[model samples]
Target: MNTCLRPVAEQDAAALFTLVDTHRAALASWLPWVAATHTQQDSLAFLQHSVAARQQGSQYDWLILVDGQLAGVCGLHSVSAANRRACVGYWLAPPYVGRGVMQAALQQLCGQAFGPLGLQRLVIDPALANVRSIAVAQRAGFGFEGILRQHLWLHGQPHDAASYSLLATEWAVRQPVQA
Candidate 1:
């Protein structure tokens, strides 16, 4: 459980892309969007954009490191000051999945986001077929709001997704350590 939510630095471009490419084929079963994700050049540019977005205070993206290795990536997207909410997304290297690594990462990031980011709520949308991701949300204390039926397109197919959310007030009452 030695995990952390650290900033996505500019230098992470190559390594992050390596993770994406390595997981590209297999991740589609869980990460539907990975199918539509950019190729090598585009992936590098996207990671660069992630770092740039952090600089502008418009978004916060982090690399999830497990004992110092690039285990995954996590982020708060679409931060809304007026709404006091944000959308969350994450992905872990294939080898790192199902070992409670993502669960730990979610717990750490959710705490920082709800506490320091001044966000009232954090929302996660996982494809219905992605059971592992749904489990992570559940473990991290996100309540199932509803299914956004056919609400998104992944790999050129309409997909149903489960929406989960956790609130700052809710986290304040729960145990700090996510079991």
Candidate 2:
């Protein structure tokens, strides 16, 4: 099995901070939420809250690793037990770009969501301009749903996003069990 999502230990905060800083400026090209985070303190607080969220059992954090290096993070930002759904998000280090590391991580996360989280569907919303991210979803078996007009404002302007999704059944059929 792929070890994409693992526990984020307290010691990993430093590396996490570094990653946040290294990509904080340029990452805005694809991620808008990151612009608000401008300092190491901001990232530390984010991680602290994330840890607390995990303990409360309503959320979980997955630190993505590629070739024994920290590549990115992914997790269920929100979860509903009765509704059987969760909102998923992820990002990767620039160095790992063009590789299939994110693809493998996506498959692993999808399996965890469908299996342990009892989620019926996993959804992703990527900005239309973010071709790289949208491509990742396409490769991961998420079919385009539709565009959400002016879904979010980013980099000082409103932007539309293309919604993509994959159902548990679809995930089951698409996952290639690694030998």
Candidate 3:
């Protein structure tokens, strides 16, 4: 998919907003933040918040670029330095789906999280009904931990979530050793 991850910046507000606006319906189906991001200003606000979170060492967000174009967004959320863990979340534009772009991006992100970041564990919590997200987590080698009933409030409504996790040890074991 020729995918790469870049730190999201304030300059991306317009493009990010356009992407979200284009996929509002699809994204809002599972991601609550979609509805809230109605304009460029909203995108700017999100980028600002992401920057602040990154500075605080609490979260790291990235833009998924496929073939040099903005394809989606992915990142480590709710990072806990003390626990050496964080949750992963991502969403791709409609046209970029089924192209393995997200899978490649995720694999790279996981590598960074467990390698340079020295994280011990990573979590993926997707709504139970979100089959695509579940498949992405599985394809990334995240193990199913169980379901968290009514775990998230989306658009002011309760939703069940399927929890998945991958440990640093498991990731290391799955990696191909270089000669």
Candidate 4:
């Protein structure tokens, strides 16, 4: 899985729109934003917001690329510098699911968050029904905390989410030793 995560750019709006649209039904089942993004303009606005958030040091958003093609999006959301923590979120095109692409992208982000960003902890909260996401979190070494009852409101309905976290110390312990 030749995958990489790069900062989202304004020029990627159309490509991003296509990726989302191609998997609209699959994505809409879990992500509220998918339904709201109807056109390229909407995608452009979303990208613009991501850029602004990065400029403000509030969040970091990236586009997942596989073999130089847009595969998905992933990022650290709700970054709290004072708390040294952040929340993670990600989604992939239907065709890219189950291919270890998202996992690789997530691992790369984890390194950035714990290394250069100096964050103490990172959390991934996926709806309890999102088995794939939960699996990714677990595989990436995030410890399951507990189910957050009614933690997310998607499509105007409440949904239960499982909270998972990895601390900087835990990440350090998981890193490979250099000879």
lDDT of 3 by residue, 1-179 (tens): 58999999999999999999988888788988887887899999999999999999899999999989998999999999999999999999999998899889988898889998889999999999899999999999999999999998988889999999999999999889999
Give candidate 4's TM-score: 0.97
TM-score for candidate 1, please give it: 0.90
lDDT of 4 by residue, 61-159 (tens): 999999999999999999999999999999998899899998799889998899888899999999999998999999999999999999999989999
The per-model lDDT (C-alpha) reads 0.83, 0.80, 0.93, 0.93
What is the C-alpha local distance difference test score of candidate 3?
Answer: 0.93
lDDT of 1 by residue, 93-160 (tens): 88898888988888888778877778899999988888888888999889999999997677778999
- Per-candidate TM vs. native? 0.90, 0.89, 0.97, 0.97
When 1 and 4 are scored with TM-score, the better candidate is: 4
Steric clash pairs (candidate 1): none
- Order of candidate numbers by lDDT, starting with the best: 3, 4, 1, 2
> Which 10 consecutive positions of candidate 3 have the poorest summed lDDT?
29-38
